[model samples]
Target: MFDLNNFNQESASLIQELQKHVGEITAIRRFFHQHPELSRQEFKTADKIAALLESWNIKVTRNIGGTGLVGVITKGLSSKMIGIRADMDALPIDEATHKDYASVNQGVMHACGHDGHMAMLLLAAKYLSLEATFDGSIVLIFQPDEEDDAGARRMIEDGLFDKFPVDCVFGMHNYPNAPIGQVMISHGPQMAGTIGLEITVTGLGCHAAHAYNGIDSILVAAHIVVGLQTIVARNLPAQDAGVITIASIHAGKANNVIPQSVEMIGTIRYFDPKTAAIMEEKVKSVAQGIAAAFGASADVRLKHGYIATVNHTEQADFCIKTAQKLLKPEAICLTKKPSMGAEDFAFMLAAKPGCYLFIGNGPGDGGCTLHNPAFDFNDANILVGGAFWTQLTLDYLA
Candidate 1:
């Protein structure tokens, strides 16, 4: 365990050691940033990562799920293991930051700091393999398609845990608009689950001048959209925090003709499974009911998305205490409330006892929010993130 009284002194030494390798860490991050790849298509990225792990003498397993890779470093047979995950996919956004290391694959950029995550985990693996200070093992998961195909679930379905079993697992993301190197974690639901909703209302088409001759799907869909909003505000309890967003509506191409059908697309965000269930049921009922009232029928399609990222209390405490010992007091933040965003790591946490936390990425540089074309992962975070992973592994395996 890290002693609060000696944390400052000990952390200083640990950070200094991590700083020595900053050059290599930043270089690796820049390489990934420049050669960004899309989900499940990270061929070159996986090659680079595998080559690096092999160079460090760590056991490497490839193709767990699409382009996913696993690096194992075992120190002794303690029967205790931990898994750390890093996403390895870029988004379909053009680079706008104009950084020297900006993505060269035009219209594809690592706009979500996944490049930074890869560098951090790789550096940690390098250090642990060299130091051999622990008695168990560390499993490094480099997953693909985090933004699209539910890569975490794919890896699990492909037998990730069966092959590389672990007592617990962990994951981290860079928090935008906060001081660089700062850490935030909490118990219970730290991020919401998402459900994508699409509803199509069908009706008879008619001439614009003779509107009463046919049923109006546009009107029915508009009613359904407005009715869906009531699920969170008027239907759900006041204490429950849920969000229903009608993000898109498509009706007719021509203003002169009444469209035969209208489509409504939106999302349902919730922390509690019961809340999500109720919202789904309500959306279907309201859409069908409204369409029936308007003399039309509705077809509802729901695409399930990431689930709520709930953290184990003990694991969350361990994360906080580890961060408090590894960094300055001001750098540790005990989050007050969960964010509305969703994460695929929620799937990994569902199978293991662990927590998914955030490391700060400093202030917004005009367009630093996640998934933005101008977003760039701060290089200053490398040392801090690498050191935190090292200390956590050491303490946990002690």
Candidate 2:
């Protein structure tokens, strides 16, 4: 075990050093916020990150998974390696905050705090490069397409682990609900697995005046949606949690003519793998049954998404203790509830023993929830986050 007192003393000095670059860090974050890019299409974003990493004398590898997902490696003394990841994707939301740094792209915004994640990781890379503080190699991953595509899995598929396998991997996301300067770590499941589903109900089109002449696909879709709720409310165990939400429904264009097909899109979230499988089975069964009852046929397509992020118990404890020593004891939260939001970092955890933690991005007073048009990454948490990352690297690699 590492000495907590010594770690705190070193971390405090490191954080103070990090504070000196707060202006540059904040500027980089805002530049990313203003010129946001979407999913697999982050060309300029990747270039900017690569340039910065190269300037720090860190080895940069580009086009690993796709146009995005830049990997930077800092060689150290120890043979053991650890990975730190930060996402670099923006959403398709138009800027609504009305700030001067609001996104210049009409419908692209970094509302999910990826900009801040990238900035903090970059700061950590610079510090580690200059100080050579950690003993083992550290891999800084700036992944893309986190909002839409599973960039983590893509990178893994493209030989991320085979090329640079690490003993442990760590990831972080900004949490708006938590107070600023705080860190939350949880054991076991930290985020629910997500499945994107599209259900198409086909029926014979007819005039609205003739009610009995044709099957109404809209009615079938409605029944299917309501019935799918039973999968969570009744089928799953009371202790387990799951959600089935239908976010979109497309059917008739005109009031007079019934449409031939009705398309519905939704997402399913569950923490347990068994529960997730059961929910998928139930959804398919409900869609088929409801379609048959309405004299229509249904086609349900399920797109496998990110797996649930389950933090290793020992790793979570280690992170909590390290965080407590670096920051105030009150600033460390250990019992945070798992969120339904999905993360691509789940892929990294699936391959290695690791943990994904939440760092406070401050309250949503004027700021908005993640994925919202008005959301912006908070600069106040830069030192706090940089300190945490630096301390975690030293503790794990020592």
- What TM-score fits each model? 0.96, 0.92
When summed lDDT is taken over every stretch of 10 residues in candidate 2, the lowest stretch is: 1-10
Give the poorly placed runs of model 2, Cα more than 4 Å off. 1-10, 69-76
Model 1, residue 297: displacement in angstroms? Answer: 1.7
In model 1, how large is the Cα lDDT of residue 239? 86
Cα shift from native, residue 149, model 2 (Å): 0.8
Candidate 2 lDDT, tens digit per residue, 1-398?
Answer: 11223235646676667767768877988889889999998899999988888888888888988965544555556788888889988998888999899998998899999999998888777777776466678888888888887999998899888888888889999998677767899899988899999999998899988968999888888899899888899999899999999999999889999888999999999889899899999999989988998889999999878899899987788888888778766677888899898888999899988899998777777657787877877787766777788778878888
lDDT of 1: 0.88
Residues 88-129 of candidate 1: C-alpha lDDT, one tens digit per residue: 999999999989999999899999999999998887888888
Give the Å error, residue 41, model 1. 0.7
